[model samples]
Target: MRRNAQALFGLVILLAGIAAVVATRDWKIQTAMYPRVVGIPLVILAAIEVVLSLRGAPEGERQAVDTALSETLPPDVTARRTRVAFTWIVGFFLAIVLIGFPAAVPLFMLAYLRGQGRESWALSLVLAGVAWLAFELIFDRVLHLPFAEGLLLQILRR
Candidate 1:
């Protein structure tokens, strides 16, 4: 499930990046620079993720991540938690698709922390607040990456 989840997310990213890059194909070279620079790498990384997941783990080499996880939780609990984790991931992706990152990030963070992490409301909110600030400051304010708006927004706008 873990590898499959990774592959699923990778495909999503790859398709989106490819679309962005293709959309810029007719633009001037200067105008195309940003999307190509970002989208090309995103496509490559997503492909890598897909490839790695398909290849499976190396033979005779135990994965440290799996080992650590096993040490932390029993097999049954680990399996249950892993499935829950994947569900959360899919949920977050849906939230982003429906609501846009500006709203989804904090909402996902707060809900995940409170519900899955079983954290206190105050702590969950604080962590979500911190994450939102960091995202806005680093990505939106400083880097100025143009994030795709939600599909719902487009429909609502029209």
Candidate 2:
């Protein structure tokens, strides 16, 4: 039953990826590149998963690839860790919404690396710099994608 459910989920993802790829047909190459890059792989991987799931791939095989922490950790510990993970995810989205991507990207990287990852400050700063540079060069310089200013920025400008 679980295997069948997995296959069904994979099929749904595969269909969504197909829809996204098809929808990008009228978009400019630069505008479509991100979606195409993501969607094409999504379709291929989901199809593969559907095939594997239908083939009765053993649960052990899948578990080896992505073992759940809940299986190993104490329930309380797992719950706490899950909450922390969700907090970081929610904080990331909040940062983006509040400060926009340009500022939020490096800021989030630095905070996550130093806070959660327990990396040295120097390493965090260097990694943040590299991430910021890559984001600027690819999205800003090459693609010329215009990220909308955050609500806070828009309000401040008025």
Instruction: Give the winner by lDDT.
Output: 2
lDDT of 1 at 54: 72
Candidate 2, 91-133: lDDT as tens digits: 9899889889999999999999999999999999999999999
- Candidate 1, number of clashes: 0
CA lDDT, every model vs. true structure: 0.87, 0.91
User: What is the per-residue lDDT of model 1 for residues 19-46, given as tens digits with 9 covering 90 to 100?
Assistant: 9999998999999998899989888988
- Pairs of residues clashing in candidate 2: none
CA error at residue 22 for candidate 2, angstroms: 30
TM-score of each: 0.55, 0.57
Task: Give each model's clash number.
Answer: 0, 0
Candidate 1 accuracy as lDDT: 0.87
The 10-residue segment with the lowest total lDDT in model 1: 58-67
